[model samples]
Target: MPLTLLPTRASYGPGDPIGIELRGDPPAAAELSVWRLGELVHRQPLLAGAQQTLPELPAGGYGIELEAAGGTVARTAIEVTTDVRARLRYGFVASYRPGKDAAAVADFARRLHLNGIQFYDWAYRHADLLGGGEQYDDALGQPITLDSVRALVASLRAVGTASYGYAAVYAVGPEEWPAWQQHALLRPSGEPYALGDFLFIVDPAAPEWLEHFRDDLAASVAAVGFDGFHLDQYGYPKHAATLDGTPVDVAESFLTMLAGVRDRLPDARLIFNNVNDFPTWSSASAAQDAVYIEPWKPVLTLGALAEVATRARAASNGQPVVLAAYQHVYDQAPAEASDRATAFTMATLLSHGATQLLAGEHGKLLVDPYYVRNHEAEPRTLEFLTRWYDFAVEHDALLLDPAIVEVTASYVGDYNDDLDVAYQEVEVAEAAVPGTVWRRVTRAGDGLVVHLINLVGQGDALWDAPRNPLGKTGPGELRLKFVRGRMPRVRVADPDGRPRLEDVEVRIDGDHAVAILPALDIWQVVHVAL
Candidate 1:
């Protein structure tokens, strides 16, 4: 007898009543138990056809294991926290080989603390979608079996991770591009806009094409059971000519399609990729569940990383921001160099309240669009990532809060005088430093958070390229302006894998508090009570 637990629309919150349905025939007598981090939290005897409520629990992660007689039959991941901030921990997975990678999916959730996964390049085709998928090759020629996709989704759900299907909004495969010529967008001089040689761009405004895309999306949702979609774009041809030689505004057309999707499938989740910040504001309509951007070029400095995320969130009217900042250093640099670069990059984005989509299934760093081109992350890199992910989860309330404000001291001559936080061994740089400490400040709840990323001894601010390890920089003085009553209690969260709140004393000089920050390593967060 196969056993299954029905999925819910949204994640459960602490103490929320959970009523789950079990499908398929189970043993006449069974035992059900809920475990969190290895400790059993709830347990009861299971009757084949009886309904029951999960035990009230604290906010964190839990797992449900069903056993028949003495053998374990099923294990389901259950998240007990519904903090909206938790949504910022999304990770992308595309390298899995479907049914063979069910364990990999569970490993991803367990290792990264990711609450959601972007099942990239898992569709049958960009145009046809999963129109009752058979054995079809994905965009990159990877054989895709619909049964494998379904199994992967089921496994991910059992591990408490939401699955999102990846789809290009205006793309059509070459085989169908000829038929979609009339619906294709034309350049000023009349040329079809193409994204590489794989897919051609189509005009979303064309009613015929729009209907096809919409229908495919709906059919895909029903066929594969995707929690949402990761809509992709190439960040070009913002405005193009239609079949009738009429100009079409791409952003408006995108918004129309997104709004239409919401109306047609109100329960569907939508996230559009604003490639390299193009049309971020124009596309950040209410229709989008989150504003997503894949920053490249022009956005080099670490400060600029924060700026990009901050700007996207602002444009989206407070919608969550997901930055698909692919870390390409793993293939070009040593393990230590890659680890430092990855940590800085992640810290910079998280400091600005942005979710990341870099790691995929099997601990691979997504460097190229083709999942096959990704590099296997180093062992140490995975360890650091685990620590980084855990820290982010522990402080989601502070790091992911959208209401936070950026109050970092202004940069001055390679040294921000306000904090006196600069590199000790090398010259200070303005961007995501190869030397200086990158800092961002924000207010959450009754306290303020100062995120300090140690970029000391590192070279270049670009996401890709080789860089050195932490330089000779040590602890430095940190000063901030505080106006709340009572002396501010300070706490620090380092990349040491733990976030214990400690009472820190500061020298109050009038309205400012002067404190000596601990020696820098990679990333640290200082919380000041308001």
Candidate 2:
């Protein structure tokens, strides 16, 4: 007989002791290891016919493995809630076969820490939406079973992850384009506005067309059990002509559609794509669950990345910000280049309080439209990803604090010195780091938090470009004007998933507090207790 471990509950809160019951004809001795995000936390001998209690742990997903004399036998997953303040980590999937992806769900939850997903192209047709029967092939000609989609959604929900179905608000497939042609947006030349050879843009403002979408959305929820809808739109036809030769404002149309959905599917989650900066026009709507944006050109460079995300967050009115900044790594570029790009982009986004909407199941890079292609990440790159994700989970409080504000001062660094704010009472000195240094100051719980991003040696200011940048080799000096009597404590933390708290010696220069940070990497957070 095989040894088995049964967990009392599917999920456990941080600080809660997990209860497990072992059974079956086990070996003389066996070891049970409680691993949190791939790191072993607790290990103990497994006693047959005995109920065991795993020690309390920080909030995160954990895996319990039973290793016998022969090899590992049974495994289970448990989630511990630590801090839920950060925005949901989101990802995507284009092709999800039924019996497959189901078993791999926990891997995504435990590894990437993802709590939401964009079920990209999982529907039958762009126009018909969920009208496809139980079995159909997607636009990419990949076979997909509607039953499998529901199964996947159920499996994700079981792990506390929600699935959002992908649907184009205005796009209709060519096969269904004939009957809907009357509702299609027309061009100034009196021709229908066709997105591609096989798709046409429908008029969202058209009463009947709008009703069609609303009805289809509700039907999709009923049919596939999609928790919400991933509403998409082409970044075009900003201004266009309707079938009746009336001027159509795309932004207003989108807003109207969202409001309508809120009225209809009041409980459904809605995530609209603010293609580029379309949010500037329609972000004020109350129907969106989070502000989603796909950054385009003119917003290249690290500073620009921070600014764009900040701008979107400002417009979101406290809603979470998700960036669909896809990384075109793997098969396309060198492994080193891919690693550098991933580190830089992820660090920049998270440091600015934004969540990323990339990656997919099975450690695959989401590059193609179908999402069927599997681009495996290099071993070292995968390690970096796991560490970064775990770091985000651990430091969600300071990095994801919605109330924190970005302060501009000369003390931070050069690129961050907006308005050329000259130093007066406070001064931050730079080490001999190779790249450009940028810093963001925020007010964290009873402390001043400073985030450092290293852009040095990265030639192209473009966020997607691949290049190697050296990490800071020495400490960066900081001097602040402190009115407090004694030296203040300083803490430096990186996304290496390691707990690091060091008190830097603070020298009293009149009424100022001066401290030094050991080093900075792709990203680092410095907390100065008040």
Candidate 3:
């Protein structure tokens, strides 16, 4: 006999109904009891071969007990708490085995301050079948067995991080290749298209394929005991067969699968990883909890990353936007180029609207020895990321809010062959307060916190420069402005995490505020109370 609870959260809010599922052979008699603080609140007879839903109860700690004729028994504790506003959480995925040591992976996760750990490609056959290949496998060919997964989950849980399973629900493995290639997503022609070597896109419209995918996903979810699924798909069109006998819309099928999964596991959190198809898959907003975009092709610089974050935030209706950038590609020649790219990306995302971060390691996973060895030589980059994790956790409240104001451009620059250089300067007729460069900004309690960055290192001396194209520095002082109300206390934080309280000169003459800084390359975070 096995009994399970749909939501494993120790706490729930008021008016939330509890779902209880029991699986066992028929019994002569069965009873289920709900207890609050050791008092029996409700008692009911259990029906054989059916799930039971407990009535909604008040918010408090609870305990459940079950008994049957054969002396079968089970008990568990539960808690109910008010639902606080959700904030942006960071996560990461680790693939490849680094010496088959689970602690190493856990250590890496802790260093990153990642709230979620994704078991990347554990069920795939290539890594499982090919043994230890240099190109495919890291150093150890450790297969992700159930026990290993459980251990990893426990490790993540110990560090207060959620665990999720990564899988391609609609793709076929290599063992089923060749024959399955015929059903692969075609490139307008009848020939079998290639989506890398391991994955062959299956026509979602095919009845047999759709059935196989649903079963596979459900079974994987049950076997892995993961909190949710990280669904990955190559957002591309297909000229292949359809499941319902008509031309299949791969994007629609993807959403259909997502909705079906949501129906099956109502409590599970689903995140979609489409490289750069957020606009096309906007329909997924209704089905998924978070929207993840991997903009790798355009190779956008820090400014471009900020712009994408703005667009993604709009598409998600103010949900968290995750920017997946390849640090190595930004500057591959210099040893510290990758680290600079990562820092710049994080800074840009934070300035935009506190977007999620995704750092990619090409040769091997973070825990791999090769990666560790290479990283040891350049330790500053690793240290920088560790600090970033700490910063994100500290300012979670400001990052999750929804308020924004535009000020002035302090400095602007471009990446010249991977080197970040500041070159352009614009002037404003009047000084303005701190403004949000990104489209969407998170609320900072009663005040609005905006992120400002200085691209030029030498601009620190330009204290009297105009704040914007139409504004000039007024009285050689910058003023903080708000939406024509009681002015609140203002605070600022530099890139190095220093905070200060100062009176800002502002002119809210036309639904705007202005602030002037004395630097060319400086990032300022302005906090304005509403």
Task: Report the lDDT of model 1 for residue 171.
Answer: 91
lDDT of each: 0.70, 0.69, 0.49
Candidate 1: where is the Cα deviation over 4 Å?
1-12, 16-80, 83-86, 95-98, 409-433, 479-485, 507-514
lDDT of 2 by residue, 1-530 (tens): 44555455434556666777665665667888876534478899876466778887777555577787887665555556653323567876666665766646545554566778788888888888766688878776878898778877887776566788998889988888887888877877888887768788978767788899999999999998998988888777888887777888888888888888878899888888888777454654556688888777776665677777888878877778888877765557887887777777787788788877767665667654445665666667766776676566556666665787766454454554211112232233232123456666777667777777666555555667676755443567666666456557766777652333335676665655667666656677777776
Q: What is the lDDT of candidate 3?
A: 0.49
Q: List ranges where model 2 is wrong by over 4 Å.
A: 1-86, 368-374, 410-434, 471-473, 497-502
Please give the lDDT score at residue 359 for candidate 2. 71
List the candidate numbers ranked by TM-score, top first. Answer: 2, 1, 3
> Number of clashing residue pairs in every model?
2, 2, 31
User: TM-score of every model?
Assistant: 0.81, 0.82, 0.63
TM-score: the better of candidates 1 and 3: 1
Candidate 3 per-residue lDDT, tens place, 360-451, comes to 22212132212232223245555555445444533444554435432233311222121111112433221111321221223554555555
User: Which window of ten consecutive residues has the lowest lDDT sum in model 3?
Assistant: 415-424
Please rank every candidate by lDDT, starting with the best. 1, 2, 3
